[model samples]
Target: MTPAVTPAARPRQVRRTLPTEEARDLLELVRELIHKEIVPVADEEEAAARFPREVFRRLSGTGLLSLPYPQEYGGGGQPYQVYLQMLEELAAARLTVGLGVSVHTLACHALAGYGTAGQRAAHLPAMLGGGTLGAYCLSEPASGSDAAALRTRAVRDGDDWVLTGTKAWITHGGIADFYTVFARTGAPGPRGITAFLVPGDAPGLTAAAPERKMGLGGSPTAQVHLDGVRVPDARRIGAEGEGFAIALAALDSGRLGIAACAVGLAQAALDTALWFTAQRHQFGRPVLDFQGLRFMLADMATQIEAGRALYLAAARLRDTGEPFSRQAAMAKLFCTDTAMRVTTDAVQLMGGYGCTSDFPAERYMREAKVLQIVEGTNQIQRMVIARDLAGPPGR
Candidate 1:
């Protein structure tokens, strides 16, 4: 036999360490699941705008859906930092799935943070587990980013409240098992708003035709019509006049989820670009070999890495229970902008192929634009940051 040939040394495992091992393991599990289940069917589902209800059930079965809430409520009780990482990984593969998680988490927040003990005990288990999915109903035809202007009305009759209004751009509009609805219970201002948990099957509740969106088409977004929908007083979250505060706080946390998604999308674009550049030829050489092209790739990679760092820093602050609203806003603003830049560059790097549906760069570009708009517009994020720097609201 020929002299024993040593097998080529296996590539060294990077062994990147997160702040917590548990979080790292969770992220790895999410990545594995997305690659195996979500990625394979993403394109087809997106084309049809079909909500991946089964995939969500599978995610729930994995206990991924219940993270970031107390274990008593059937949640995984993981910290926000870990939860955000999972969101990042999911969004990187398919934004619809990522938004589903964010919407569910927001629903859970109303119950976990503000609900009465009876409400928590009654609804938390199903909501946190794979058995039920939840939606946030705050935006209306008159209010999108200006959520405080929602026109939904809730009038008390004896022990029951009759709700009437249309909530717009509701994720999981047609499929959610329950809705965390914010309706006017007092006068016509933020002080009048009150939060409620309305079952999906409640009489007089219906979802309009889903909105045709530029991206994230796999998630159903539509107007939720509540016509004479009745809810029990027991379902109210916190006291009256607390709705606006609760909504704002939930958004502070939600922004971080969007930022994480942006980071993942940018990373996907960078990875795809790198792979394409390595194989595509130009002028008798690989496109990646040219100095100009190489610099563009370098800049793209740097932006993605920087975006990741910013989101993680904000996440850490959140996990530690620090005042992280400004940090969260900053991360959302920066990461989304970076995603737009990197994905656009990715398309340019791939030349003709990137602009076509044969590749995902164009899709990635469309998705990146929505990130800048949702959770809160990038302009709103800047205002939040500036306000924080200027001190309190009155200051």
Candidate 2:
């Protein structure tokens, strides 16, 4: 994962209010890791397009990888609010690490949430704390946002199920130790899907070359081909045809992770802008002295603070076991949009320097854009929010 290459002076984040001392300590540990390990090598590794497998292993060992899971399952047992704050800090340092952690957590969701007791006992510990990596396989080349329309087929073959399909846009595709795969097992819609925990090394499982993307270069996004890969019945998560519900539930939480990452990225951009404006000379003084630029900076900071509060409120709702899907969607939508806007303004504030690779402003701007499209696209989030507000579309 690449580190934040904003400036010599690292950006200072606002102090957060935590519910417990342990949560507060966890955040401090994460910050230390970012400073000591991530921030230094981010630019070099990003330019090389290298994936930091070791960094994830370290995160796993530190309990950051499974913070929101239950303690009985070898997880950190922290609340979602605390877990998300950690994500934001990691993302501020580097998106590859932040998004990778989110994707891994999403990959573990199926088994942790819906797997039988026996399955959890068998898999949860290794997944949560054994330094193993995972990939979530739900989207396909043919299906992106329309998840229910996925065409991957899983056929029951005696005690094993043979899965055959290509999963697209999978983070950690080839590198993951396992995959949480959703495939069609019965009819042809959401009701037909089933979730399976497939070992990544299973026969006939392969990953195509990673896609060249506009940003987040250190994170690999690839198409995983499951060519008649076989998984035991023991690995199936939940009952048959219940995968869609599980996937939707996982996404509700996953959206919150994306929101936190967005806020972090925006904060990084804002910090870069702040640093640049203060140092860059204008007609007679620092550019930050100008009213127009100061106003822009003020607006950027306000949007970021608002986005953070929105996501945190949604997280609190989830922690209280209240309905939070609509709020999650709203947070994802607003936070990612805020990231895109703040990063763009950061680039604008830096003038010519921001446009160059010598500075991180342009890179931050590029990275901000993908947040708007990931988890659920901002457009999709709007649809979800609209559905919650007005009952579904023709109602």
Candidate 3:
């Protein structure tokens, strides 16, 4: 029951509706950058497991790294919707860059949304646009989904807080110039937590060897160990016990970023399938000419469009200052699930070739698996949605 539309002859040229000509121009610039700087080297860099620090620097220099933030702080002053669409474009080219940007944005969220005016004025310009990468440190070796249970501790000293613990599965872990760390300052659990902006090179702060991830190998994921790493009270984000609330608020926005990335990855997989099918001969004609394969591609495109719409709709809610936590959860859940399905189908459409490393289908499929797990798992998203719908389980 879906209408068929002609696919773009080239990927990353999908049609869009933007709020302003500025947004349209920004997207075009992103596509150009992705085509020139990201896509060509993506497979090779990922294969070599090389972290593209230079790519991030380029993104930062162009102001793409801080699009969703305010222009006064050296950002592009774009809306959430515009920023997310740009994420989609980057993700279609390479997940490392796209998700890396998302993680960096997540790292900045606490400071941007909850920091004192002095903190923002002092740090936002550099953090947003001064060619520095950032990591978010919420997860630990034990506490991932249950973030509030984090064991990292921050003890008050005369003029500083000494932090000690291990933060696990941190993107840009070893390479980031800064870290947004959540540490326990009082009793256990969420309310006892506090957020700190810790310099990456602070004394006794170190990163473990990068994890051997299933995909996005070009981006580093490592455990950051903080042993008596001292941070000034001036660096604390929000009140003494407001870190968990700040973190939750940040995640609400972060989920939408993940959703956009998922949609873009799906679009990439679908594009790959489209190109391969149209060229591969089956019997006397192209595989895409077959009814079954055609239908499969149709479904893939349909799913991609639906996912895009879902994320964009949630982003619009955020742009308009609405409570979008539930919508964010739904978009994250549906778009990531769609990415998994579409990437799997892309591989299926390519037959044995899809399973091989020579093509991108297998890689996209692998990357899709991670999306469902990050920014809170799909299971968590479902829980969030259910709680919004029927109140908490006890109620």
Candidate 4:
């Protein structure tokens, strides 16, 4: 067996205990790609609030976009554990890229997992292959975490379906090539919802201006309006009235993605804090030599490690086809909160420098805040875990 790279040998490397040689090789490739393509331009592109469409296309060309899905339909055929660890590395480099990949995976779930065989053959290739992007539409203006309360409606019009309503907080809202939309099709509540694959250029489908976010300005988040958008019956995923279940299922994996991204952000903050303290001298000694500051770095490192372990555990369960919802919720809640604390402390460690955009600590703190809110809020994650623990809301 070949020896793995050690901290002394690869100082800036993210040490991973991967399950396969292929996975390790893949990680190395990802890091090289980040250094060559992403890192040099991430700060500039983000500052300009420019989306990295070509970067995503390059990633798709590299097969990074389809890592966890089966390969027969143009995916990478890696396990979720491996795929999410890749996400962690990406997030450490840039949040917009990491979360964009996550949302794209979530968008493909409906068709990849439940679409008719014909549907998969027709669309999965382009979506998972390259040059095409997708968005998942579940939340609405009035329904963020109360996804079941969404007002989007899909009415039957003979052999076609007409979708109407707005989907809020949609990542890649305007730039996506397709949208996996869930809308009311039956009566009311979760059971009434049906999912559809709507083309981004469909008549009456439009995007509002992107939101001015606290961070991740490079990511285009906006409300996607489905104003009488029409699609063929063949576009509907799974059986009618199954959209809520599908959305929740997609969110389980999505939560783990957020958790992985959180760990990566926390890890990045810790790395910056370590480097900052080591180089700066106070009282004629490196600040890292001070016990108080040393303890802070220790705590930050411990929290990041714990978060990585928790999210990886959840991802492994997903790989094994086990009941992982509760674990996913726990990972999402704990990891995001850890990110918030660690990033804040990272800024404190760097003192005034950290608070400025010149350092990444302040930016990491802002980015961490959003992870706690998306993929179901931390509050909602608690609810999901509690419901899993004590049974459903009613029984």
Best candidate, TM-score? 2
RMSD per prediction, one decimal?
5.5, 2.7, 3.7, 4.7
Ranking 1 against 2 by TM-score, winner: 2
Least well predicted 10-residue stretch by lDDT in candidate 4? 2-11
Writing each residue's lDDT as its tens digit, candidate 3 over 29-109 gives: 898888788877888788898888998899999899999998988889999999999998888888988899999999999
lDDT of 1: 0.84
Stretches > 4 Å off in candidate 2 = 1-8
Q: Rank the candidates by lDDT, best first.
A: 2, 3, 4, 1
Model 4's number of clashes is 0
Whole-model lDDT, model 2? 0.92
Lowest lDDT sum, 10 consecutive residues, model 2, at 1-10
Clash-forming residue pairs, model 1 = none
> How big is the positional error of residue 220 in model 4, measured in Å on the Cα after superposition?
0.8
Q: Candidate 3 overall Cα lDDT vs. reference?
A: 0.91
TM-score ranking of the models? 2, 3, 4, 1
| Model 2 per-residue lDDT tens digits across residues 312-364 | 99999999999999999999999999999999999999887889887878888
Which tens-of-lDDT digit does each residue in 1-395 have in candidate 4? 21122211111687898899999989998999888888877767877889999989988998999999879999999999999999988988888999999999999999998899999999998999867999999999999988999999999999999999999999999999999999999987999999999998999999999999998999999999988999999999999999999999999998999999999888888887887777767788888899999899889888888988998998889898899999999999999999999999999987877877766778889999999999899999999899988998889
Query: Positional deviation of 308 in candidate 1, in angstroms?
Result: 1.4
Q: Candidate 4, residue 64: CA error in Å? A: 0.3
List candidate 1 segments past 4 Å from native. Answer: 1-16, 391-395
Q: How many backbone clashes are present in model 1?
A: 0
| Candidate lDDT (C-alpha), each | 0.84, 0.92, 0.91, 0.90
